[model samples]
Target: MSQQKPPLQNRVDPWGVLHAVQARGTLMGNRGILHDDQNRIVRHWAGKAWLSCVLNPPFEQKRSPFSQGTYSELFFLDEATAFAAGHRPCRSCQRGRYDAFKAGWAAAHAASNPSADAPTWLPIAAIDAVLHAERIGPDRRKRTHPSALAGLPDGTFYAAEGEAWLVWRGQSLRWTFDGYQRADAPPAGDEVAVLTPPSIVTLLRSGFRPSVHPTANLYN
Candidate 1:
């Protein structure tokens, strides 16, 4: 006689009760939640899910230090779920092989006639110019303010109780979000801005802390 496994339960859509669905299981990665039924893996974010037949593999440097396996496929419950999950297109597989694709995208936008405003990053700057070229109709509103992070020197970074960040040599600063929006600028003067990494953010949000006992993530 063969043993039987319990049927997978449906995942409750976090946004609303009416939007729930049965989910088989979940996979973890740098990206968001990857849920699956026995037949196909799906990634879910916000309230959406997408078919994950195509996997955007993680970069070599993105592997875990103490863990065993490399990153598997990027999955989602649906396309809306992926976007709501806050993932853009993968920098590796989907977008013109990443490098060439971004380069061409930047160049094409640069050729168009537009304002002379400069962007902090070249490729992103070019795209911004093209997107904001038109000025007509009602007054537009900006959501998030531009954070220049102009002063933080390269190689120097801050580590706070909440986040981990790296200040690159290219005058760019990258930090993970803690779900809470920061109102003030990073830090003034010589005080270093301690930034927690995304993994840390995920853990903290889940209610674990340094003083509290750590739970083993058996899935890993």
Candidate 2:
């Protein structure tokens, strides 16, 4: 018999669930420590500050071994997928992207503040608090809001007929553990359950373009 591979516990989906999959993605992420010494996932998360990072970040290199940190190392197929999972860019490793994300987030939220002079910059705690409310509800379940499919910006993930789909460049792409596959275009008037949090969706609307798997370009 062929030797079976040990199951890994760090593959994260858009809803923040972890799975054992062979497909390793371009981006790495985490939400505190959820794994035990055996590398088994013991909890959904330990904190609300979920973050997406570059693979094998140098900053992480100085802290501890990859799998020895307080958080279990997680992987995402692309930045878009990571964002949909309620993760923001890691400041230590992805400084440039984090700056852009911070700027975009401030701008997005400021637009709706109904104040004449809203702050253009916000603290990390403030940002995380807003994202935490939108991502996890009091019931510890993924929170979703309704939005018309056509009105959503690119990189906004939504659910329909029990499948996850990414809205990109006027297209809907199905999300798999491996890559994005094309899905049938839904009606312009169809309202769907948006998986990406409202705050992140607003940030996307403010033009914070996420890096998607190259497969997303296949349909174009």
RMSD of each: 18.5, 2.3
lDDT of 2 by residue, 62-154 (tens): 553236557778899898888888999999899999998998888888886749788888899888888889988889998888898767999
Give lDDT tens digits, candidate 1, residues 41-154: 243222211212223244444542113232223423332222222222344444542344344444433343245762223543343332222111133321111223454333
Model 1: lDDT equals 0.29
Q: Go through the candidates in order and give each one's C-alpha lDDT.
A: 0.29, 0.84
For residue 146, model 2's alpha carbon misses the true position, in angstroms, by 0.8
Candidate 2: clashing residue pairs, number: 0
- Runs of candidate 2 with Cα error greater than 4 angstroms are 1-4, 61-69, 185-189
Taking all chains together, the TM-score of candidate 1 against the true structure is 0.25
Q: Estimate the TM-score for candidate 2.
A: 0.91
Highest-scoring model, lDDT = 2
- Report clash pairs, candidate 2: none
Root-mean-square deviation of Cα positions for candidate 2 versus the true structure, in angstroms: 2.3
